[model samples]
Target chain A: MNLETPALIIEEGQVRRNIAKMAGIAAACGVALRPHAKTHKLPEIARLQIGAGSKGITTAKLAEAEIMAEQGIDDIFIAYPIVTEAKLERLATLSRRINVIAGVDSLEGATAMNETALRRGVPLQVRLEVDLGFGRTGVPYDHALELAAAIAKLEGLQFRGIYTFRGFFMNGAPTLELEAAGLEEGRLMVELAERMRAAGLEVRDVSVGSTPTAEYAARVPGVTEVRPGTYVYYDRMQAVLGSCTLDECAAAVRVTVVSRPEPGRLVVDGGSKTFATDVGPGAPPLHLIGYGHILEEPDAVLERVSEEHGMVRVPEASPLRVGDVLHIIPNHICSTVNLHSRVYLQDGGQMRELPVAARGAIT
Target chain B: MNLETPALIIEEGQVRRNIAKMAGIAAACGVALRPHAKTHKLPEIARLQIGAGSKGITTAKLAEAEIMAEQGIDDIFIAYPIVTEAKLERLATLSRRINVIAGVDSLEGATAMNETALRRGVPLQVRLEVDLGFGRTGVPYDHALELAAAIAKLEGLQFRGIYTFRGFFMNGAPTLELEAAGLEEGRLMVELAERMRAAGLEVRDVSVGSTPTAEYAARVPGVTEVRPGTYVYYDRMQAVLGSCTLDECAAAVRVTVVSRPEPGRLVVDGGSKTFATDVGPGAPPLHLIGYGHILEEPDAVLERVSEEHGMVRVPEASPLRVGDVLHIIPNHICSTVNLHSRVYLQDGGQMRELPVAARGAIT
Candidate 1:
């Protein structure tokens, strides 16, 4: 295909298989699948997911949601707490065009969004985010009902549901203990949903998902939807987390070996700017070492990466030479895909370029 | 200026001051200044550097050089080894429009470039890269003369000079011992230039520079040019390395405090996608902790960064609220700048947006 070195290659068949697998899991668990668009950021991929039984798409920022909505994606869930007036205005405008659901944790944040929505004469739907275990954002599980009630009472805002990412449960492959933890977290979220509903707040969607805990969390009785982003293109992190195998990874970075300066030392065109310095979510296990898994030389370690140079150290008897091509499975596919402007889709040995529509929309 | 949160801010006055300071260094050392465009990819910044006594501009990638040339930057030195045919063809096209000098380390690479230039009937200039202890790429210092002789004999290619980056000496700020090491490396490059010249090769330029050793490398006898990119926007890494004071840093990322999940733990909108996970060129010392230096709270440490969330741990007495805006001096300004699509220029308190023209030009 004469693809350029350091290009992102997405095996279309593998991607479709991944999407179908996740969709089947969601179906088996009786939950709606709305994959996160922040991972691939392509409307084409979002469309494929929607076609594969996804109800909508999830975005991490308002900018990403706007980009998706512009490309005919009608339903978007921005899983970020929008705070500023500028973003609120954009969200209000977006709400007028599409079905928009935002994740809000605080009463003040909800009030701000309500004010914007009221001023813009648009009805805004919001999901009260709960900190199940990951303490990054969302109201505390103890305080979730209170915030959800406040959001329901807000003038122009509708409390649609609740959303929580199982980031704290993200570690190595799901152990029996980890599965039990996920089940307990799921029960807590279902309990929160029941409490919110009892408080006269109509909770429709109870969202729970992370690549590691998606299987367990989706099976929760009251969880209505799952938002597993990395499942679309499972990476080394997902593999190490026991979510997928390395061979099942749909995306890889194709790079040219530029320099072999020493016996076991080789340099590739991709570096931190390409692969990123993400080992995995949470702490990596002992088997998951190095920055990425080199497909050409599985034993070779991506030792270090500067902006534009990735140093790979192989065995002393390595047969790697300059100008050789290799593929790298990144540690985190979401951030790695976000780094490139375009990604190539490989379908039946034919290559097609897809623009990463929301590459740097990190608002 | 009521700016958006998680925005890149470039202080115009400080940038000019940094430019003038580095240009002054080059002038004092009797070397031509060519600031690298890879750091601040804006052509506006390049024009300013040239206006501040720089002879031309330097780019780390051919794509970056092409961008500069499109914006009327005539003289460019792509300090990266170009290997592939697609890049060679682009280099030929670029050489036809402007003055282009590429860094070459191998005879085969030189032959490929020479053949492309010959086919296109365009003259291409190349610098024989000498391994001055960086060991990333380049011909060994002892074998550089032979490669230079081969390149000089090739048709349609001009052997312009010998160049080396003092990457090994790039650690903390110029200690006396580090300066001596820089001087020693410079001498080795100068010796290589002499050896090439004696072997019937015309060596017009002897280039050496890195932010840490620019001063000493420039002062070496017979060195004609110096390229230091990060001097345009000094960062926390440079400050920790003793190259610049915190006040001298020209660039910062302005972000709003988004979430205060717990006591002593705050979350900002900027994360690994904004600040990046770079602690600068060499290993960080003890005092240099965290991903960036927070402006409002100097003692606050950016402890962890996910894709879109930067978790900050401040002192127990932190009075930060939900919407307080703060600027962060990134650990490595170059990589941080690359992440953003636009950088705001603060000139005399007036805000102006400058599109990062050559950003993500890693190919």
Candidate 2:
């Protein structure tokens, strides 16, 4: 495919290798690798992950899960908090085709899930999500025990287990202590599961992991599963967050030099639409001076991105000419990948196309 | 629409008023209005703008232009520096349906477009985009004449006029100077047109406008048209850019507070997914704060956004429990609107539904 500049290029070999490597790690750890399909909505990649030992998959939206199930891969986990009536109706239909695991933190939400399950005459599976310091979602650590117990007692609902997304486990968390904290969080979750068991409820699964904390949390005695999405296409943000080195992060948005009308400036076709404007904490607004490190210097920063162009402030003088192409690893790979409908593969300068199966799972 | 949180809302009344006001301003200034359809990306909004005296519609993509043409829009201008082969093929198809004018800044690009048009056995209409001090995509002012002349001489292509987006017109180019510079730029375009004509070529149109410069640029002497897309839905960035106030802004994303695990920390269903993480030239990085902002106060800063959750640092020591909904005015409206499939509307209180008719105009 002769892709326009600034297009998200997904190297097929790297993507497959990333998919398989994570699958191997999960297999080695003895946890059901339900690789979060939310990271890459590609049905083909989901099948690859499954082939590589993934028990099933996970999505962020019902529509995405539905698409995956339609493609014949069942047993899906939608990690998003499902609260809408429309979503519940879809979830009800989804239950017949696949084993669906939904996330819920509130007692009211748990009850609603139970109610929906009863209406469908099927058991709705749920994960008692705990806010393990992300401050994003889930019950507080103090409130987790009660929520877990309530979920365990809810009728027409199977308390699958407890799950938490340690997305906030970024560079802010020191590496040495980060793994320690993750293990301790797993311990607390294990304690919660013990409480569920003491209350005469079966707790089969205790799952948790982000790309940053999966290795640490996976070895924790009670964590039966781990879901890390960004490991597949580690981004500049992930590199900064210390999950992977620059070379290990194997996806980039390839863009063309569209306008370089003057010195100390150059614009590429990839803008907020292609690369996205996601700068992780402590990073510059844009990795400027170079939208990317020209691929050779794989660890270099992608210093700039505007709406329809990226401003790469070249060093002294960029060897790049007006039509030179460059590869840019987005700061946040997951969101950037989600912005495009297809990914390109560049092998020996030949670009192949790969559909981003879950590009618009915005619901 | 009784929209849930994290929903896009557009007030019909405000949108009507904004469209009409811009149309009115352009008419009063003796310029034609060609409001960029790329802003609303909706056929209905195109109709509205056309009904309000827009002579034509401008789009950034051929898909958008094709959609508009299918909806009976006869004239359209694609204002991006389009050079892609696939897009050119679509442009050929679009030209068969509508009066398509494309932006070209380079002689090579113009020649390529003419070659494509000739191969398709169709004529290509184009405008030489002049870079007027803004260093985005365009021929520099000094070089615009040469590019224009070369394009005019190219077979199967018509050199319509000159164009430039005043994006380089500073972040918030003071409204007074904005209009003055626009008028001066218009004069320059008109002078270029005269120079081209003296060199035995006809110059027909001179167009330019964005949300910030739309009201002023249209009044520039010799300016024939305006293309302002975001006017229909002014975002917080536009408010900051002094284009419109929050009230006059037409759209906001309605999101729900899903969890408040602790005081001073609240999470909403809307995150970077709904309201993208585009910020201004501020420091400490805009964070996860309570609500992207109360719609009533567009300038009230929204501090944080995660993928599935928006962590809003509650401004005051107040009780913000679960199940509360708030309106989020994204930092950038154009990109945020593109993320959703459809927008649920309201006067923000009541509810209705509208398909963002042009949401997926990705060519």
Model 2: how large is the Cα RMSD against the reference? 3.9
Give the per-residue lDDT of model 1 (tens digit) for A1-363. Answer: 777778999999999999999999999999888899988989999999999999999999888998999899999999988888888998888888898899887776788889998999988889888886565777878878877776888889988899887674333243434466667767788888898778787889888877777778888899888888998999987787677898899999999887776677888888877887644323434246777889989989887677888878889899887778899998888888878888999999699998889988888
Candidate 1 residue runs with Cα over 4 Å from true position: A168-178, A198-201, A280-287, B168-178, B198-200, B280-287
lDDT tens per residue, model 2, B20-139 = 888788879998888877667777778888888888888766666777788888988888766667667778888887788988877657777888899999998898888777667778
Residue A168's C-alpha lDDT in candidate 1? 45
Best by lDDT: 1
For candidate 2, lDDT tens digit of each residue in A1-363? 656555777776777778787777777778878888777778887888888888898787777898899888888888877776666777888998888988888876777778888988988888878877665777887888777877788888888878887655433443434577667767777787887788777888888887777777787787799888888878776666667777777788777665655556666676666766655334442223333445743433445555555666555455654556777777777777777767776665687787776666666
TM-score of every candidate:
0.94, 0.87
DockQ of each: 0.53, 0.38
The residue pairs that clash in candidate 1, if any, are none
Candidate 2 chain A has its poorest 10 consecutive residues by lDDT at A284-293
